[model samples]
Target: MTFQPAGATTIAAKTPASETARRNQPLQSFDLLVGPLSFSQATRRGLAFYLLSDGIAVWLATTGLVAQAFVLLGLSRLLAVAFGRLAAGRRSARRGLVAARRPWLEALLYLFTLAVVAAANGTGSFAASLSGFPASQALRVSAATAIDAAVGYLTVQGDGFFRVVTRGLLSLLKGLEAILTLTPWPVLFAVIGFAAWKRGGPMLLAVVWAALGYLGLFGYWAEALQTSALVLASLCVCLVIGIPVGILLAKSPVSRAIASPVLDLMQTMPSFVYLLPAVAFFSIGKPPALIATVIFALPPLVRLTCLGIEQVPLHVREAMQAHGATPLQTLLKAELPLALPSIRTGINQTIMMCLSMVVVAALIGGGGLGYNVLFALQNVQYGEGILAGLGIVFCAVLFDRLAGSGRKGGA
Candidate 1:
């Protein structure tokens, strides 16, 4: 054993109670007093912006500066949302933090929507001036004249071309309708039932029968057939156009750049707006209605087709190329096969959208159960409208079952 010098020793000395208590005590830096919590940073900012914008808009409008409030709110809203969106990049990607659309655009939309709601709320004259956005009459007239002139030019100059188109579409539609309407009801029912049974099992078979029974019992079989034919015709046209366009979009960025905005306009524009061009080009008839329905239903198919092809695995494409596969061969054998499920989804959405256009189609002289609803609405026959509307719903279900029901992998 080694000895220590002076006061240092091997054995520990006993300490007084106070010294012992203080021996291993820790110094305090901070204390915790949990009680309540406020909104998170992002939440706080978003709420503040929403409140400030509404508050400031109300104050300004109340002060009788309507247009000024609109202009200033535009700026204040920008400020409120300046730090609202989290930084989105490769490193910062999180479940819901990243915006699918541009932040500024979304913020602007939010402001507009907020203003609209505030103005529209019952008796909320508090925000009454936000919705007044009248375009100049001269500008509106000029635009209308330009549109009319273009339509006249097309109608006059392209009459032969449009006639050919109309004839072709009409023939296809008529042929399908004739088949649906002229076929023996029993045969059609058996075929539909068998197909439904084979594809979707007993439950789907039952649903299909119920829907068909509704159509038959309600004396809507012929009209329902007409509606079905229209839907089928539109589907055929969409497939022919949408698949090729989708393939092109997947292969070429230029085509995508050109087509995407057009697709957006097609989708976002009111369904009624489609009737205008259809009427201008094809005139008011079944052909115009079909064209409008096709245009409205086409975008989803094209978009999904492009998405599916683009989503094909890089290595799968590489393998096909390595195997000396031509572009067409690779697309047919690999990409299309792999993308089948997505394409099927697109088709499903297209079918539903087509059905939705029934009433719209009726407005343009397309005949079907939609005509019944239109007729009822004209005369205020609530029972007829409700029954006809149900017929359309049943038709939608039937078409969806027949066209969209399949294996998940598109088998």
Candidate 2:
């Protein structure tokens, strides 16, 4: 618990027990095996006895003699307890209880586990059969029917707010597609290349140019542009939603506890699973595709942004506070700057996720290189599918490089 000067770096010191162990080396190579487990003189014998017994119990269990296994386990546990008590002779009840409890607890656990295994094998049931008149399919159908009825009721009754939002998002996606597809290829290339150069230097700029050039040269110019626009739009949507939520999560432990499982669900569910809800709400098109992409790719940025902010070196924030910096000032100047590299990494992963969903996104009405790839798959055009896939790879590489540069620069 030694403290250093505020500006000085801290190094960890070895514990006294470890230093003692190092100084008092074991007498033989075999003794070295017991060194780690022997934290105290009395416990060493107890541990060794318990391990030997436990091994025998496990071996007996593996031989299909369940009753014998339990007997062995109990016998070994009793022996360990006896040894421990012998070593701790004439101790108080409290101390004796503390010393003896470990073996009893371990024995009970092993006994219970063996009993369950024996029961399972004897009954010929792994999970055991359930006897009931329950109607699972009926329950599922009823739930689905109720939900569909409710949604239909809402739709019929004119849900202005929901309808308005859906329409607006759809219009926005359409407008973005038109702009990207209508823009001259050379102009788009120059704009992207310039951005790459400004953020990533000359090497990245060349990569960006080559990737874009290949897309155009291979006759995937329009599809590439469309996919780029869709991916960019989805990324923007993810950031707009994810960052604020991430900041909230970082600042509030309660929010983090609530969000952890939701993020897990978002990340764990298949990408296509999102499309079902999107289609239900938006009714299938570019808008639904965009929404699904955002959902699929958003968790990483939110989780990483939260983690980055939380890991902003407590001392640095404290120093900022000591200098009369407000909370927002400390966060923006001290925390966010240090967290920039991690946030950039989050953004990189989000972009890649969005790109990966391109072909899946095309399954609905969302058109792009995904649509081209899907068309090839349907028509059995191997060359077309391969070219489209290569186009996607090129775009992914260019974006990945740009993200790498941003991350390094932040670092």
Candidate 3:
């Protein structure tokens, strides 16, 4: 053992008491406040600001100098900024501002700005004067004219092209309807069951069984089939258009830059907006309704498809290239397969959107359960409306379940 030097004192290690003392020391530095009263630095500054601003307001109003309130407000804000920087610097030099402490100087400035404005002239009155400044109507008219001219130019000039495309879409829609409506019920049921079994296994097959039985037994077989046909036709068109565009967007940043805004507009636009343009281009009927539904439902698939492809593992892609796989093979064998779940989710959302548009579409001569619901509404038959509404719900749930099955398989 070593001997200690004479006159040396030993230092003790920190105990729990010392730690508690340290914590309490910091607490002593704060000026605590409860309820309406506060003695903290921020509170004191805020109180000073409140009194000063009010004094200024009272002087300005009493002296008939209220017109200078705006200038006073600006000066007060500049002063507050200066005070904030000073306080921040002081705090940084000290123990530093703790998490619980707040910037009261900034709060004081905001409070003064609002109070000064309200006391000098009412906020609403100030806003009204701005609104009545004679420029609002001109702006509105200019915006409306621009929108109208753009719409009219496209509609008038592109009529021939739209007409040709509309005819082709109409033919395809009609053919799909005929196929679904004209097919024997047993055959259709079998096909659906087989598809369900192949994609989703026995449990999904049972669900399909129950769904088909519900429709068939309720004398809704024909109308249900027609709705299905409409949904399928729209789904087909959406996939055809959306997938290619999605691929292009995924591969090219330039394409994505151009298309993303358009997709955002399409997705956010009101469902009714889709129908108006369709009605203008094609008369109110299944063709127009189908076109409207297509517009309403197509964006999600494209967006999700692009998302899915982009989300594919970069390492996997690199591995494919390392193996000398062609771009087509890499996409088909790796990316698309992995992206199937997201794409399926997109399809699911698209189907639901199409189903939701049915009632709206029915308003324009698109027939099915929507027509029945409308009829019930007109006649005030609550039971009939409820029944038809259930029919639509059933259709939505059935398709949703089928689509959901693919997600599990994809995973």
Models 1 onward score TM values of 0.72, 0.68, 0.72
- How many clashing pairs in candidate 3? 0
Candidate 2 clashes between residue pairs 3 or more apart in a chain or in different chains: none
Q: In model 1, what lDDT does residue 101 have?
A: 22
Q: Give the C-alpha miss distance for residue 51 in model 3, angstroms.
A: 7.6
Look at candidate 1 and tell me the lDDT of residue 16: 63
lDDT at position 247, candidate 1? 90
How many collisions between residues are there in candidate 1?
A: 0
In candidate 1, which residue ranges exceed 4 Å CA deviation? 1-135, 406-411
The alpha-carbon root-mean-square deviation between model 2 and the true structure, to one decimal in Å, is 9.6
Name the candidate that leads on lDDT.
Answer: 1
lDDT of every model, 2 decimals: 0.79, 0.75, 0.76
Tens digit per residue, CA lDDT, model 1, 1-411: 955455343223566655533432321111001101333333322444355456767875786645456665655455434333333233125432222222343356556655554454425545454445545999989998998998899899999999999999999999999888889999999999988888888778888899999999999999999999999999999999999999999999999999999999999989999999899889888999999999999999999999999999999999999999999999999999999988999999999999999999999999999899999999999999999999999998887877774542222
- Residue 68 local lDDT, model 3: 68
Total clashing pairs for each candidate: 0, 0, 0
lDDT (Cα, tens digit) per residue for candidate 3, span 1-411: 966555333332344655433333321111211211644334443455455555665676676645666466556555655666566557745753232224465546655665555554545665556444456888899998998788788888988988887788778878988888788989988988887777777877787788888888887877887788789888999999998888889999999999989999998999888887787777677888889899989999999999999999999999999999999999999999999988989999999999998888898888988898889999999998898888888899778877765532321
Ranking of all predicted structures according to lDDT, beginning with the best and ending with the worst: 1, 3, 2
Worst 10 residues of 3 by lDDT: 27-36
